[model samples]
Target: MTRTRGWLAAVVDIVLIVAFALIGRSSHAEAASPIGLWTTAYPFLAGWAVGWLVVRGWARPMRLWPTGVVVWVATVAIGMLLRVLTGQGDVAGDPLPLSFVIVATISLAVFLLGWRAVVRLVAARSGRRGRGRV
Candidate 1:
């Protein structure tokens, strides 16, 4: 991938976060307005930014193990921490509920890391095929 496509990866991460928020809101039957979606998205967005820093994502936006995993983990960790602090997290009977943590971790992992992994695989196969042709 070229340097220009790095921005596309960033955009994808942000869009995925927004989509996650939209789907979550829909699942809960919450109001799906721009403001509401933004509110739901901001905490995780902040975390996503931190994940970028933590993983130095611009350097390797599509690296799956450290780059993708670090981003995914940081997005959930920092996002959940911020959410709990701000009282926007999905808390039920308990303050730091296990169900909420487990669900968020798994969902965020899949959404945040899955796309990059797919891209990495495709890029690898494309490279191999191109080499074989010449």
Candidate 2:
């Protein structure tokens, strides 16, 4: 159940990130390319995998937020580097503002952290109350 929940959280986070990117793109006139598409999608998938592995598999709440932050930051940096290496396009396209990056990072971090917190809190409370009865 925990594993399933963690994966669900990750999928939700991916959706949220994509939504943010679309919202940011609404203000722009040009259509984003396929190269840009992968740039946005891959990072969230990577972050999602890491979040699930660390939080659900290991049952470690302490690692959730910090690891998420690290993964998101690194993902962004690596993405920029990849775009630069390929020279396919500018790292910061018109749609992806600095503000958008910050918001996306926060969104991913919060979703990952909040899910773990809720799961642990519920389990802890249940355990405590259950112990009293048994």
**Model 2 lDDT per residue over 14-70, tens place:** 675565445545545435665555555555555545644544433432344564455
Collision pairs in model 1: none
TM-score of 1: 0.90
What C-alpha lDDT do the candidate models reach, one value each? 0.83, 0.54
Error of 1 at 113 (Å): 1.1
Off by over 4 Å in 1: 90-93
lDDT of 1 by residue, 46-129 (tens): 998998887788888887878788888888888888887877754664556787679778888888788988888898999999
Clashing pairs in 2: none
Highest TM-score: which candidate? 1
Compute the lDDT for candidate 2: 0.54
